[model samples]
Structures are given as structure tokens and as C-alpha cells.
Target: MKRIGVIMHGITGRMGYNQHLVRSVLAIRDQGGVVLKSGERVMLDPILVGRNGAKIEEIAKKHNVARWTTDIDAALANPDDTLFFDAGTTQMRGSLLEKAIKAGKNVYCEKPISDTMEEALAIARLAESAGIKHGVVQDKLFLPGLRKLAMLRDSGFFGKILSVRGEFGYWVFEGDWQPAQRPSWNYRLKDGGGIILDMLCHWRYVLDNLFGPVKSVSCLGATHIPERFDEQGKAYKADADDAAYATFELEGGAIAHINSSWAVRVRRDDLVTFQVDGTHGSAVAGLTK
Candidate 1:
């Protein structure tokens, strides 16, 4: 068996803990690792890293994870760890990725890779120079519904695809009566919080892969809720945009419009849905069905 050491950072958060660590990595481990084409078994040995030692330690104990630490530098310094995975805040992802790349570790991180295009490009250049594998997490494309959508597109089910429309998001409680579903930092611009930066990245890949390459875009953003309660139940100003309405022009002459908002209540089939119209037929897909 080939053992691959993965340094997993920010697993304390909701998405990191539930989706990446538990559902993905641990689930893979439970299945006795992955079998390659040559029938070689490859095991992932993960070392969890985070800011809170106590919380991380608790998680490690619960999951039976052997290694847990708060020192990111020490984790990066270890030569045993060949891969570094992060699901942390966007504000810090660029620097963290750069550090991992310089330390000679391959990196896979959540989007947006960086808060700015310059930093994202610079990091890409540096990773190329260092000869390390790198990628941003685009989990939406792997969803069962989207995979079905991709299949339909490939089979020409949507012949001469004319347009694509996407609807996403749900109402997040303001934390006054009910606790907010999302972290408060998601509403603070200083913390790299905004609906546009978060969801547009997903749409970009979804459109390009399922429809065609996006040529240009016109977007309008809004801060639907001006104030919200934080984790501590303290009121804070939610200055970042909670919603986005965007239109994209695909290279193949297909128009794509996506509406994403945290303030909207769901009356649709799913929390998120995409409907594609074509000369031959039309279809709508959700997260699962």
C-alpha cells in the first residue's frame, strides 16, 4: 500500500468538517483507500491543523485521527506531508497556498483562490515555478445532478443550446430570532465576504463545462440585509452583498443568467436549480434530482 500524507487545514469549520473531512476523507479511509488501475492501494493519512487547539483536538479524538496541531508552520515543514488541503477563509488562502507551495507541498484549496486576480495569478506562477500540483475546489461540477446535466449536453440532448438559467441560495436567519446559518464573516467585506465572489466561481465552471466558455459578464450585486446578529448574538453590520444577479455571454452564443441570494426563501424544487433551454428540448436540474 502506498501511503500519502495530507495536511488538512481548517477542518473545524462546517464545510471543512462535514463535507471534506468526514464525508470525503474519512469515508474514503473507511473503504480501505483507493485502488489504482494497477491494483495498487493508496491510503490517505491526514494530519488536521487549525487555529483552536482544543476544538481540533476534540475533533481528532472523535474521528480517531492520530495527529492534530495548531502550528501551521510545523505542519508545512514536515517532509512527510506531500499534499496540503485548505478550506479556510478566502482572505488568507493566497498566503497559505504560497507558503505550502514554497514548502514543496502540492496544494488543493477552496475557491476563490485569492481575493484579487493579481494574487491568484502570482500564486499560480509561483506554483508553476516550484513544480507543485495545485487546484481550486470546484465541487459543484461533481454533483450528481450536474453530472447528469453534463451527460445530457454531451449526448446532444440539448441541441443548439440557447440559454441557461440558474437559481441558488436560501434565506439565512438573521440570528435575532433564529441563529444565522452562515458565519458572520461572510457578511463583512474586510473578511472577503460577498455572494458574488463565492457563487460566481461555481457558475463560471458550471457554465463553461455544461454550456460553453463564458465570453463576457454583466453583474449586479446587493446587500439585501443591512444588519444581522453574530455567533455571540451581538448585532453587527452586514455590509457585504448578500445577493447577485449575473448574465454571462457564452462563446458559443448561449446566454446564461444566474441569480444567487441568501435572502430568498425556497419555493422551488431545491435550494439551487439550473434550467437549460435549447432548440431540441429543455431540462432542469437540482442538487440531486
Candidate 2:
């Protein structure tokens, strides 16, 4: 068996804890690891790292994870860890990836790699220079519905694809009468929060991979809710955009329009949906079905 040490950062958060750690890594471990093409068994040994020692310890104990720590430097310094994964706040993603790359660890991180294009490019350049494998998480493309869509596209189901329309997001409680579903920082511009920055990244890949390469874009963003309660039930100004309407011109003359908003009510089949129209036929894809 080949053992791969993965340094998991920010697993305390909702997405990190539920999606990455529990559903992905632990699930892989439970299934007796991964079997390679050569029938070699590859097991992942994850060391959870986070800011809160007590919370991380609790999670580790509950999950039966043997290693947990708050010291990022020490975790990065450990030569045993060959891969570094981050699902932390966007504000810190670039710097964290840079640190991991410099430490000679391969990196896999969540989207919006950096708040700015300059920093994102710099980190990409540095990772290339260091010769480390690196990737940003693009989970949407792997969804069953999207996979089906990809198959249909490949089979020429949508001949002469004309346009693609995507609708994503749901109403997040404002945390007054009901607690907000998303973290408050997502509404603060200073904390690298904005619907455009977050959802556009997903749309970019979706259009490029499923439709065609995007040539240009026109976007309009809005802060639908001006104020929202925080985790502590304290009211805070939401300076970041909570919604976005973007239109992209794809390379092959296919037009793509996406409306992403946290304030919208869901009357559709799913929380997110994409409908593609073509000369031959049309199809709709959502999170499922």
C-alpha cells in the first residue's frame, strides 16, 4: 500500500468539514482507500489543521483522526506531508498556497485562488517554478447532472449549441428572525466576500468545459440585503454583492447568461439549474436529476 500524507487545512468550516474531510477523505479511508490501475492500494493519511485547537480536537476525536494541530508552520514543515489542501476563507487562500508551495508541498485548494488576478498569477508562477502539482477545486463539473450534460454534449445531443442559461443560489436567512445559512464574512468586502467573485469562478469553468471557452463577459452585481446578523446575532453592514447577473460570449459564438443570487427564492427543481438550447434540442441540468 502506498500512503500519501495530506495536510488538511480549515476543516472546521462547514464545507471543509462536511464535504472535504468527512464525505471525501474519510469516506475514501472507509472504503479501504483507492486502487490504482496497477492494483496498488493508495491510502491517504490526513493531518487536520485549523485555528481553533479545541474545535479541531473535538472533530478529530469524533472522526477518529489521529493527527490534529493549530500550528500551520509546523504542519507545513513536516516533510511527511506531500499534499496540502485548503478550504479556508478566500482572503487567506493565496498566501496559504504560496506558503505550501514554497514548503515543497503539492496544493489543492478551493476556488477564487486569490482575491486579485495579480496575486493569483504570481502564485501560479511560483508553483510552476517550484515544480509542484497544484489545482483549484471545481466540484460543480463533477456533479452527476453536469456529468450527464457532458455526456450529452459529447454524443452531439445538443447539436449547434446556441445558448446556455444558468440560475444558481437560494435565499439565505438574514440572521435576525432566522440564522443566516452562510458566514457573515461572505457579505463583507474587506473579508473577500462577493457573489461575483464566488459564483463567476464556477460559471467560468462550467461554460468553458461544457459549452465553449468564454471570450468576453458583461456583469452586473448587487448587494440585495444591506444588513445581516452575524454568528453572534449581531447586526453588521453587508458591503459585498449578494447577487450577480453575468453574460459571457463563448469562443464558438455560443452565448451564456447566468443569474446568481443569495436572495432569490427557489421555485425550480433544484437550488441551481442550467438550461442549454441548441438547434437540435434542449436540456436542463441541476444538482440532481
Candidate 3:
């Protein structure tokens, strides 16, 4: 069995709680664990480390994990050869991963790996130089719909993909009558959050892997709702782009368009959907009723 220790932070956040804490680590553990091909079980022993003690204690109790700490430095110094898993806020990611790499830990980080392309490349370079295994979460490609797309591609159902289009968005409630579902930091540019950065990272993988490598891209973004009310009923100015419209020229000559937004209302069940057209056939896929 691989006795793996993980250093986790931002466990209190939505993405961190659901994706990292629950889906990747805890949910796997609940399934009696991940088994390797060599019959060696790769077990994850995540030591919950975050800034908030109360929330960490609660999460620890819920997950039935004993080890918990607010001290990241202490955890990094722990004896176990650990994998540093970061689901922290985008702005905090670069330095955190740098520290983890310096501590001789393999890194698995959420995307967009850093706020800027430069920062992302630097982290990638650092991890490479350290000889540490590093992975950026490209979760969308693993989704059922996308998997189906992969199947179609492999089977050559769509002969010579000519063009592609994607529509993704929903009208996020004003958070006035109801508290905003998304993090307030998400709408702030300084916090390394915005529609384009949050979404296009996913598209980069989807396009590159499924369709073709992106040759060039042209994008336009705008903030539709400038003022949103916080949970405390305070009005806050949103600095981040709420929507993005982008066109991509793929290396193999296929063209694609994508629209990502937080302002449009979802009348249909599928908030994210796409259409792929080719010489032989066409397919429309998304969250269906």
C-alpha cells in the first residue's frame, strides 16, 4: 500500500470541498480505496490543513479523518512523503505550489494553475526542475458528455470535423433576494478569478485533446452586472468579467466558437451544450433532460 499523505488547504471553499475533499480523496477512501495494477493499494491519507480551525474540525469529523492542522509548515515538515494537492484560491496558488515543490512534494493543482500564463508556465517549470510529478486538474474532459464525445471521435463518427460551437452559462441570481452562490472573490479581478480564466482553461484542454491544438484565439469579455449584493446584504462592485466570447483557430484548420457567461438565465435544463459538425455527421451534446 502506498501510504500517501496530502496537504490540503482552502477546504472551506465550494470547489475545494466538493471536488478535492469529497470527490478525489474522501469519496475514493469510502469506496474501500484505489487499487493499483500491481495489487498495491494507493491509499491517500489527507491531513486536513487550512486557515480556519473550526471548519477544518467539522470537515475532519465528517470525513472521519483524525489528522488535522492549521499549520501548513508543520505538515510540510511531517515525515510522510506527501503529495501536495492545492485547491486554493487562484491568487494564492503560485507561491503555495512553489513552497510545496521546495518541500519535495509531488503537486496536483487545480486550474487555471495560476492567474497568468507566465505564472502557470513558471510553476510547470519549477515542478519539472524539481523532478516532481505535477498535474493540473482538467476535470471537464472526464465528464460523461465529454467522454461520449471522445467515444464518437475514436469511432470516427464525425468524419473530418469541420467546425465546433459551445454554449455555456446561466443567469446567476443577483444574490440580492438570495445570497450569491459563487464566492465573492470570484468577481474580483485581483483575486485571479473571472469567466474567461475560469472557463477557457477547460476549453483549452477540450479543444486541444478532442478537436485540435488551438493555433490562435480572439476573445472579448464584459461585466454585465457591476453591483452584486454579498451575503451580509452589502453591495459590492464586481471587477471581473461575467461573460466571454471567444473564437479559436485550431492547428488542423478546424474552427471553434465558445460563449461562457454568468448573466444569462437557463430556461433549458442544459446550461452547457455544444454542437460538432463534420463532413459525415453532426452531434449535439450537453446536460439533457
Candidate 4:
């Protein structure tokens, strides 16, 4: 078995814990790893890293991950650990990736890689200069619905694709009665949080691949819920925007309108929905059937 040792950062976070560590890596581990085209079995060995030693250890033991560490520098120094995967907060992500690259480890992570374009570019450039493999999550394109969209595009099912309309939002409970679903840091600008910054990053790749290059964007944002409760039930001012109304012009003269909000209740077929219209056909896709 060719076991790849991956040093995973921020696996205790929501997406990091549930999606990446559990649904992805552990799911693969439970299946006895993956068989290569050459018939060699490739397995994964993950070392969990976080600021909280106790939390990281708990997760590691719970998931049967072999190692846990609060010392990232020590983990990076391990010769057996060839890959560095991060699902940490966006503000710290660039620095973590830089460290991994400098250590000569292959890197992958959830986005946005950084809060600013300059920082994002710098990370990419560093990875390139170091000649290390790197990638940001563009998971939307892999969805069954979006994959079908790509198929339609590739097959010329959409004759001269015209436009795309996206509607995405849900009512996020303030931590008064029901606890806030998202982390409190996501509501603070200093911690790299905003509806536009979060959703637009996802939309960037979605538009680039399915529709076309985005030519320009005009956006208006709002922080609908100003005060929200934290995990400790303490209320704090939400400086980040909870909602955004944006319009984009794609390269092929296609106009896209998207409304993303966290303040609205869902009554529609899907929490998130996209409508792609073309001369030949049109289709609607959502979070679920």
C-alpha cells in the first residue's frame, strides 16, 4: 500500500471536520483506500493539526486519525508528511500555505485562499516559485447538476448560451433562541467574513467554467442582522454583510444576476438555485431535487 501522509490543518472546523475529514478522508479510509489504475492500493494517513490541543486530540481519536498536533512547525518538519491540506479561516490560510510551500509540501485547500487579491496572488506565486502542486476548491463544478450543465455546454446543447440567474439564501438563526449556524468569526470583517467575499469566490469558478469569463461586476451589500449571538451565547455586532445583490457581465455578452443572502427564509424548491438559459435550451438546478 502506498500510504500518503497528509498534515491536515483546521480539521476541527465545520467544513473541515464534517466534509473533508469525515465525508472525504475517513470515508476513503473506511473503504480500505482506493485502487489505482495499476492495481496498487493507495491509502491515506492523516495528522490532524489545530490551535486547540484537546480538540485536535479528541477529533483524532474519534476518527482513528493516527496523529494530532498543535505544533504546526513540528508537523511540517516531518519527512513522511508530503501533503499539506488546510481548511482553516481565510485570514490565516495564506500564511499556512506559504509555510507548507516553503517546507516543500504539496498543498490544497478550501477558498477564498485569502481575503484580498494581492495575498491570494502572492500565495499562488510562492507555490509556483517553489514548484509545489497547489489548488483551491472549485467544488461547485463537480456537483451532479453543474456537471450536467458542463456536459450540455460541451455537447452544444446550449446553442449560444445567453444568461444565468442564481438565487441563494436562507434564514440563519441569531444565537438568541437557536444558536447561530455559522462560526461567529464569519460575521466579523477582521476575521475575513462577508456574504460577497464568501459566495463570489464560489461563483467565480462557476461562471468561469459553465458560462464564461466575468467581464465586470456591480454589487450592493447589506448587513441585515447587525447583532447576533456567538457560541457562548454572547451577542456581538456583525460587521460583515449578510446579504448581497450583484450583477455580472460575462465575456460572451451574457448577463448574470445573483442575489445571495443569509437573512431570508426558504420557501423555494431549493435553498440555492441556478437557471441557465440559451437559444437551444434552459435548465434549473438546485441544492436538492
Candidate 5:
């Protein structure tokens, strides 16, 4: 068995709780855990590290993980730990990652690895210099629809990909009727949240993997909602974008158009979808069964 220790931050946040703790880590443990091709078991020993002790305890109890803490230094100093997994807010990610790398831990993180390209590149360089194994979560590629599309593309079922069109949106109903589901921080520019930065990270990987590397891009964005109420029922101004329309030209002459929005309603069954056209044939795919 390969013994591993993980320092997981932001366990109380939405993405951290839903995606990392429950879906990824616990689910991995539930399936008799990760196994090497040689039949060795990959034992994942995760230490839930977060600011909220009560929430951390609650999550840990439900998941059956024993180790939990709010102290970053203590987690790093432990000799048994080998990995640092970060799902923190975008603004805090760089500093935390830099500290983790300096402490000699292999890193796995959620993406738009930094709010800016420069910070992102700096982290990349640090990882390279430290010779630490690193990965950014490109989880959308693992979704059933996208995975099937990938299989078809790899089998040459669609000859040569000529163009890709993507549609992604859902109406964020106001709190008075349906209650606002998204965090208030998302609507603020300073919080490193916006439809463009949030969704484009997924697009970056998808286009590169399925279509081709993007050579150039032009985009337009808008905030359809001007104001919103915070979780505390206080009024707040929304300064970030709620929608984006972008066109990308790929290295191999493939063109991609993307529409991402939070102000639109989902009338159909699928909220996000794509269609790829090619020389031999075409395929239409969606985030639906």
C-alpha cells in the first residue's frame, strides 16, 4: 500500500465540501480505495484542514476521517504527510501553494490556479523547480457526456474536427422567489469570481484536449443583475460579470464559440452542451443522460 497524507484546506466551502471531500476523496475510499496496476492499494490519509472547526468536525465524522485541524504549520511539519491539496478561494491560493511547495509537498489544486496568468506561471515554475508532482482539477472532462465524446473523437468516428460550439447557462433566480444559490462573493470583482474566469478554465482544457490549443481569443461580458442580497440578508452591489460570449481560434484552424451565462433560464433538460462538426460526420453532446 502507498501511504499518503493530504492537507486539505477549504473543507467548509461549497466546492471543497461537495467535490473534494464527498465526491473525490470519500468516494475514492469507498471503492476499496485507489489501486495501482500492480495490485498495490493507494491508501489516502486525508487531514481535513479548515478555518471552521465545527464544520470540519461535522464533515470528518460523516466521512469517517479521524485527522482534522485548522493549523497549517502543524500539518506541514508532520513527517507522515506527503501531499497538499488546495481548494481555497482564488485570491489565497498562490500564497498557500507557495508555502506548500516550500514545505516539500506534492500539490493538487482546483483551477484558474491563480487569478492572473503571471501568478499561475509562477506556481508552475515552482512546481517544476521542486520536481513535485502536480495536477489541476479538470473535472469536467471526466463527466460522462464529455468522456463519451472523447472516445468517439479518439476512434475517429468524427473524421477531423472542424468546429465546436458550446452553450452553457442557467437562470440564477432571485432570493425572494427561489433563493440565491450562488455565494455573494461570486458577484464581486475583488473576490476572483466571474463567469469568464470560472468557466473559461474548463474551456481552456476542453478546447485544448478535444479541439486544439487556442491561438487567440476575443470575448465580451456583462453583468445582467446589478444588485443582490447577501447571505446575511444585507444589500450588496454586484460588480462582476454574469455572462460571457467568446470566440477562439485554435492552432490548427479550428474555431470555437462559447456562450456562458448565469442570467438565463434552463428551459430544456440540458443546461450545458456542445456540438462538434467534422469532415466525415458530426456529433451533438450535452450534460444530460
Candidate 6:
């Protein structure tokens, strides 16, 4: 059996723990393993790494993960581990991925690799210079509805597709009555929080891959909610844009618009909805089904 040792960083965080660790890695482990086209079976062996060893150990024990550690440097130094994954605080993500790239380990992380476009570009350049494999998460383009849309495009269902539009957002509760469903960092600007910074990146890939190459963009963003309570029950100023209104011009002359917010109440199964307008016909897709 070919064992692929993966060092999983920040698996103790909400998105990291549940989405990456439990739902993805552990679920894959629950199945036998992945088989390559070359007829070799590849098994995932994930070592959980985090600053909080107790929390890591708790999650590891709960999920039956074989190993847990707080030492990231040591974990990266291990030659047995070939891949390094991070789904952590966005502010620190650039440095963490840089370390992995320098270590010659294949690197993967959550989107916007860095808050600034310059820093993000620098990381990509460094990774290229280091000659290591690196990728950012772009799961939105791989959704079932989007895949169906791709099939439609392949079959010429769009027939000179005119435009694409998307609506995405939901009211994130302040930790006043109900605990906020989203991570607290999403509301703070310094922490790499903001709807525009977060959602536009996803839409860039979604539009580029599904619609066409986005040649230019016109965007306006806002900080709708001025203050919000954090995980610690303290109010903080939300300098980040809680909402975004943006337009894109694709390479093929198709225009795309997407409005993303965290202030609206979801009523139309309306967490995320995408609409494509074509000369022949039009279709709409939502979160699921």
C-alpha cells in the first residue's frame, strides 16, 4: 500500500476541523483508500498539527486520527510527510504555506493565500521558484450544480451565453442571542475578514472556469454592519466589507455580476444562487438542487 503522509495544520478550527479533518480526510479514511489510474492504492495518513495540543488531541481522539502535535516545524521536517495542508487563520496562512513550500513539501491551503494581492502573488512566485506543487481551495467551481452548468456549456446549451449573475449571502448572527455560525475572524478587517475579499476570490475562479476568462472587474464594497460581538462576548468594530456589489467583463464579452453579503436574512433557499443568461435559454442554480 502506498501511504501518503499529510500534515494537517489548524484542523482544530471550525472550518478546518469539521470540513477538512472530519468530512474530508476522515471520510476518505472511512472508505478503504483512493486508487490511482496506475492501479496503485493510495492511503491518507494525516497527522493533525495545531497550537492547541489538547484541542487537537481531543479532536484526534474523537475522530480516531492516529497522531496529533503542536510542533509544526518538526512535523514539516518529517520526510515521511509529503503534503502540507492549511485551513487556518487567513492572516497567518501566508507564512505557514511559505514554510511548507521552503521545506519542499507540496502545499495546499484555503483561498486568498494572502490578504494583499502583492503578497498572494509573491507566494505563488516563491512556490514556483521552489518548484513545489501548490494549490488554493476553489471548491465552489466543483459543486454539483456548477458541474451541471459545465455540462450544459459543453453541449452548447448556452448558445452564445450572454451573461452570468449570482446572489450569495446570509445573516450572520452576532454572538448576542444565538452564537454566530461563521468564524469570528470573518467580521474583522485586520484578521483578513470581509465579504469582498472572501467571496470575490471564489467568484473569480467560478466565473473564469464556468463562464469565461474575466478580463476586468468593477467592484464596490461596504461595511454594512459596523460592530459585532466576537467569540469572547466583546463588541469590535467591523472595518471589513460585510457586503459587495461587483461586475466582471469576461474574455468572450460575457458580463458577470455577483452581489455577496452577510447582512440579509436567507428566505429563498437563497444562501447562494447563480443564473446564466444565454441567447437560446436561461437557467438558475442554487446551493443544492
Candidate 3, residues 165-227: lDDT per residue as tens digits?
999997687688887778777787877768998998888889999999999999999999998
lDDT of 1: 0.92
Off by over 4 Å in 1: none
lDDT of 5 by residue, 72-148 (tens): 98998887998999988999999989999999999999887899889999999999999999999998887877887
| Per-candidate local distance difference test | 0.92, 0.93, 0.86, 0.89, 0.87, 0.87
Weakest lDDT window of 10 consecutive positions for candidate 2? 263-272
Cα displacement (angstroms), candidate 6, residue 126, comes to 1.6
The per-candidate count of clashes, in order, stands at 0, 0, 1, 0, 1, 0
Kindly list the per-residue Cα lDDT of model 2 for residues 112-186, writing each as its tens digit. 899899999999999999999999988988998899889999999999999999999887899999988999988
TM-score of each: 0.98, 0.98, 0.96, 0.96, 0.96, 0.96
Global Cα lDDT for candidate 2 = 0.93
- Can you tell me which runs of candidate 3 are displaced by over 4 Å? 287-289
lDDT of 4 at 84: 98
TM-score of 2: 0.98
Worst 10 residues of 4 by lDDT: 263-272
Candidate 3 residue pairs in backbone clash: 171-264
At residue 39, candidate 1 shows an lDDT of 100
Clashing pairs in 2: none
Clash pairs of candidate 4? none
